[model samples]
Target chain A: MAYVSEKKEKGIAVLSTATSIIVPAILGVSLIFTMGYSSGLIYIIGAPYQLMSLFEGIIAGTLVFSFAGYIIGSGKTYRLFAGLAFGVAMFFTVYYIIHSVDYVVPNGLLTVCSFIITGAFLPVSQLATVIYHGRFLRGLAVPAGISVISIIVIAELAILYEDSGQSNLAQIVTLMNSVTLVALILMLFVLISRKSSGTGRIQN
Target chain B: MGSGSLLKISVIIVVLMFIIIAFIPVASTSGVKTQGVQTVELESDSGTRTPIKHVINIYLENHSFDNLFGIYPFDSYTSNASLSANLSVPLNLLSNRTARDMLTEIPSGTFSTKDPNEGYVSYHLDFNHGKLNGFLNGSGPQGLTYYSAAQEAPQWDIAEQYGLADNFYAPCLSESAPHHLYYVAGYSPIINDYGPPPYIPYSQSIFGELSKYNISYGVYLNNTAYRCASWDFLYGHTDYSSHLQSWNSFLNETSDGTLPSVSYFFSQGTGKSMGPPNIILNGEMLLLYVIDAIEKSPIWNSTAIFITFDGFGGYYDQVVPPVMDGVQLGLRIPLMVISPYAKEDYISNTQMLVTSILGFIDYNWEMPALNKMVDDSYLPLDFFNFSDCRTPIEFSPSAGFPVPSNIHFSLVTNTSADNYSSLFPMEPQIPLDKLGYNRTGSSSVNLSSMGVGILNKDEHGYTPFFESVGFYSMLVVLEIAIAAAIITRYRRK
Candidate 1:
């Protein structure tokens, strides 16, 4: 906050961060869901020439907000930056998977579910190394594992929705899908119990 | 400012410039997004029907004049003044379509035709180099045998009584769609449509025009018969169902004398679904069938049967195809017109395509409403002997040998000095390992979706899972790792 107030350049950084990281994550998700049946739609809509506006704007916005956050509270250095990047990458992947399913990914209900999985999976996976081994990014492992499980559950949902107008993801067509959902549910239970004492740093 | 800090400012400036350049567009287009490319829509190649009759046309798939005629036993057939001065020129004769598999590389003896089961990952014009952008190379038994040429031959022989063109050639060197487009339309721009697919539509085709005159046309395919989308547009616009024939229904054609003015018959898709190895002979057989039909039909002199291949199977031909867009389309393919009006021992050098067939129909019947893509392209006038108009004469179909599967049609080598040092990449020397088309079963024998000759030597054939977003994301990860290390070091200090 002080940096942006003290220097004009800091404000520009905030704008850059929003432009670069935030926009693509959102549009990329939206397109993935819509381009289901007409897979070929990727060619014209995401044309190379059009990238001038898409990817650039995203990186700019990401730079601004992220750099501003870094300066606040004794400068976050690289740990926070990496956490955010992993989270965004996870969101992008989820968006792509839903979009490529070759069928409409349901408007309100399915969309919300997809976002949840994206939000949970990425950080859990990246921080796994740190968590088990008691290292730098240990906090991220939980979110990363959760993201993997979420993909399975969501994939089951997408396929179920395609097969029937309404899908119960628990009824999986493949053994793998069912196994992932079961594991994620159990993992989520353990995580919630461990966090009940409010001793974990992840919340902050 | 001190030079030390000046460098940092410049670095910041460059990074900001790159980000700004990116943002200006990304921020603006955040509202818009797309999935894939859209195919082109244009007039189809189907022709219109009219009264005045006699039409003759021909198509050849991959064999170039030199590849087919270089070893032709012409001395025994036509003893000319010179030992064989002009024999290599295209002959409109009824000869065997089987030739020895051409070499995979340009110069003969330098490369083998034996295909490596490298998966599509390795399948490129050349594997070692990073360029897997163009077409697949195959050694003979002319990899040109996709359609059931042998099955259609009897029908074509009967129709050729009116005319035959010995000097026609393929417009491009690449594959099935481009050649088919060239045959039906004037230019093969459909191949160069770098945008979305369905580049040309049937509504813009010759068949589309023929529908205007109520002339019927049908293209029966099997499965998602992967070729030009124009085929679908034509079939769909003409109110014909594109029945996907199973292996058993391969020959189940319901078209009798009710056959449309232009009826295209193929085994559908590629490989085992097309029936046995005998399927490669479809082009020859279809022509014979057309010939038989014309002999039995009320419109004998008024019909034309075309037999052409989609592309050269990355094999070598001695001759140089005419250049388009600074790239060579490969050598001249062997095109034979089996018509009585076709001058015997006559060789014409006029370049032609599928559209010219429609153009011939337009000129003969004076149908002004033929699809313009075909009508718009220059007709292959030089190949036809226009000096005299003669009545139809019937010729007996000579029984050719049971068409051979093994033959050699070697590609000529690159002796050019600037092979690699040129401004851009050119076809490299054929790898010595690819000798013959021994990999006949290289393609999926039965499955329509499975393609044979999957080369995995280079990254060109297959898209890495880490392409696009994966690549950039990894770069971002690296930057984050660096920042993390810097922060950790600061904490320790």
Candidate 2:
């Protein structure tokens, strides 16, 4: 009975690491394909071309999140934060590079920055919750679910606002990003304090 | 619930999300029909509708509006007055410097040995946020060469006889490849200077939309592969392969009265024509041949031929292109619409892009726009006047003029030639197999002749067959990875 329980624990650890890395990577790639297909379809259905940047922001966001998740899932806290920082920096770097040379979508800078901030923070917070709550897949799954729901809500709101000519999409996306960043900062503060106070530890 | 059950549920949820995200786009676009006002209509012998039966797009190589059409006598003050005599109206508006004024500022010649800087970066510097003052200063002295009206007489004669669009801009501020993609796809997903990917799936192309509606189309090229057809959607798809044909086949079909509803003709680069460092006169001759072939064909009465250049080949143009999103619209290129329904001696000022051609086709067929950019709001269809279809306009082929006989020889001898040298190094070695129709797939119907065969390698080193294989290999890897993950989880059960 003791041997069986020990093997089960090891299996859970392996599964947890694998799910944490693979799930986010899959989500990132899947979101890119989805955005590409939907943008193409929107063109076919005669939607405005300006709206494509919104989907482009989603793709960039998910890609950054996946990169951060890969590092964090390896069970290295410092490395995970470093990766997130590097990803955000690189996002801005690439945007400026493309801007200097080729044409970037108008008002794309703020939208991409917002997406990176949201994507980086949300996933890290979910990982923090997992460490504290002692739940393996639930941590990742719940956050991903919330993200999916939030994206739909944001998209719908943008469309409504655009259709009604009440506000530009870039303004809406910037506002959302601002809110997400605030929430992310608060979550990070709580997680860091808990670790410093010896109240919680990430399971390996 | 056990951890295994929880894992299974998570996987199921991810899969469900993927399916839902994927299905939404397909569901939304599946049954939607084109809506809005129809732009062009006429009472024809067959019925009361658009009299246009055939649309042919003939793509020529680089030459800007000011470079070619600046001295074409479109102004009433000029000797060749075709439009209204209004001295107050500016013949060609320039925000900072005019093309005519720039003519004296830089090298004035028929042929340029040094190519001007027309890359994406150069375009940005030259545009300068619509200040438009950087033509002579941005790219040095090479930016000021404008072809004389005498040099471009053949094209001017055609424009004067048919219709001229003085304000059409190249869709994107890039090289030939992206603009060619925009010519067919309406929107180019590729932002950089890269050539067409080896294979694009059917879902990503306007040809896919045409195939769905069973609308017959063909792409005819001299000897080179049509850049637009290089996408997997047209080449890899066995059903659409036969639609690719040679220029000769196009002529034969036109004479045989078997031309497709829509057709595209691409020039046989420098050897025959396609300008810049090569002889400009040779390109004019090729244009004359194309116009003559259509004029003598049985389908001439029902056909509308659109002739335009892909982009300004490092030449000076007076107009500053409008900015949208982050992309600055490319400089103005000459556009001529020649059809029986085309208004005589008319000059249209409708602001248009290359995608306007695609828009025109979609409007006539009642097909949905390829993308939002290809919709009526972005592209102007007012170039054609179909009010009087009873009297069909006729055109006589311009008389042949003296062309430098040894232009090809001179280019071949000059081993140290620039980028334009490779465009027409020698006469294209046309493969025999590419001359006629080679049908594939389960369908017995021979749609058209397939003329896509191996040609001289491009500068990009795109091995056609190898690239397609690489794309497929990546997809296979993705599938295997997914399968492995699932099987590993199932074994733990």
Candidate 3:
């Protein structure tokens, strides 16, 4: 019985190792493609030059979070690094995008505040990981995977709108914005509740 | 494995992934592997006999020769074969001792200044009466920055595979409008960026010349065909108007293998113009589309694609414009010749003008020179090795390799939005004071002297409201709504 249990644990470990590497790799490629298309960098289908550096930042942040998370394992240290990475990514992405289009240069305080709001999700996500254990990452990966698919669908629809000569770009953008907002909020609420309700022995 | 081993493994895997992403060969969209320039040595006798039947002139927007091809023989980008082969060196900025102080290589993909005062007066100031050192004072450091193969891989790729003319010069030392005039008629009345038509007479253009000989020709405007007023600077030419067609018509003609013998594909407006804020990627994509279309056509073998710019819009060039009839030529602009008969791995040092296209056209059709100015111009025929016809080279973008489906084969149809405004602003408020013109702020140029009543007023106002609002509103609104939703959802939970 002891030997059998040991074998099962080894299998789980191998599966977990594969999962960590493959998931982020897949997510990284999809994230780049979707974000690139949305930003008009990938598809030259009449979309103008967008904030290329900003999109690059987002992709970098995602990779850093996933890879850093895997290396540090589930702990306060991983959460801290993840949050810091997210904060930096958020700040730069906002700064570059705003800069590219000649908006009022964001003040330091505004940039800090913006990143703080966005970076708050990192800690909340870690809380969910503690509560749901190993399965939590799989659950977290679901939203990103879905988002990648959703963006591609939206892009296809945008092309249809382009072909029809009626630019519903405004509407499509609004729809995407609404969906992202709702999804983020719902995930936060679920994670926060799972933590507050004391469902599992939350590790550090 | 232990947690420590797992951590090591994760780190290794993540680093590997990033390395792969970093080294992802740009211009892989065409799916063809990057090959070195095919060193097909041109025989001395090969240059005399020519077989080029169809001439497709793609007149693009501003870029100096040095700005685009300053660092030729790009050892890093091309293959060992190209590096090992005896490549002829053209008179580039790197080779010139006079331009040594001005040889500041900007990083690849960096855009020059937006709206660099590139009118006649400013360009002359930059020219500094042929001294060529006043670029810093005239157009700022932006005029000093030049690109290598890194920023313009597709261009360099085509140049490497076929022919690049390092000494090609624009006809006029001004902005788009004047150079465009000089391109068609080999002369322009105005020297500034804009002037209302006391225009060149209609019967004087190469179009008129072609029509007179019953030779097929076309002026295909890609972006601004229908929306733009038909203010053909040609005053009273009836048949000249018939040849001016839309982008779709050009594509259809190419598709049917019925493209005109002398076809001029004009890419203008916003991103399409291959100008500032460095959107050369868009230009490259468009070039690929056009080249691919031609390759697919039945007339591919006979067609010679002369890809040249109108003027180097305030960009840095070491070469001084040569004086002809008291009008100095504009800065040296890039000219890449791509055809089956174009000499492989060749760089022509022959001094040529934008009017040289007219010269080539006239020469090819066995017609008279458009004028004395054209007659004196050196033909760009030295770039071609007509004795040996090779296969068309496939090209891909340097960065942002577009998805195959995303490559729209057709140009703009009926879209009201001018996506190419960045390439050329639709409504330029001409700096009348700088140019010494009396016309203030977007006034119509009257061409009554040439019999055309008035130049068309730009209906589309210059408001880049689409970019800022279209991009940020989506991001900001989403963030705000998410914050609100999180508050509401968290309180309920």
DockQ score of each predicted structure, in the order shown: 0.03, 0.03, 0.08
Q: Write the per-residue lDDT of candidate 3 for residues B371-402, one digit (tens) a residue.
A: 66676666776666566666665543333332
Best by TM-score: 2
Instruction: Please tell me how candidate 3 rates in CAPRI terms.
Output: incorrect
Candidate 1: stretches off by over 4 Å: A1-204, B1-70, B73-169, B185-198, B212-216, B220-230, B233-257, B267-283, B324-328, B365-377, B382-493
The DockQ of predicted model 2 stands at 0.03
Question: What lDDT score goes with residue B399 in model 3?
Answer: 33
For candidate 2, write residues B329-434 as lDDT tens digits: 8889888888866654446677777767776666566565665555532333444556544233222322233223322223332222212211111111222133
Model 3 chain A weakest 10-residue run by lDDT:
A41-50
Please provide, for model 1 over B1-493, each residue's C-alpha lDDT reduced to its tens digit, 9 standing for 90 to 100. Answer: 3333433553454365446545555632331121111132333443333332334333333344433333332322222314233222333222433322322212311111232211111112322122322223322233322211112222222212222233344555444444555554333433321211233333335554444445445554434344433353222332334422322232222223333445554433433111222222343333334444455555544444444444443333433345442423444554445443333333444554454566655554334524433433345443333333334433333434122231111212322221111111111122213322110111111111222111111111111122223323333333333323322322332
lDDT rank order? 3, 2, 1
Candidates 1 and 2 compared by TM-score, better number: 2
Candidate scoring better on lDDT of 2 and 3: 3
The global C-alpha lDDT for each of the candidates, from Candidate 1 onward, is 0.34, 0.50, 0.53
Q: Which structure is stronger by lDDT: 1 or 2?
A: 2
lDDT of 2: 0.50
Worst 10 residues of 2 chain B by lDDT: B439-448
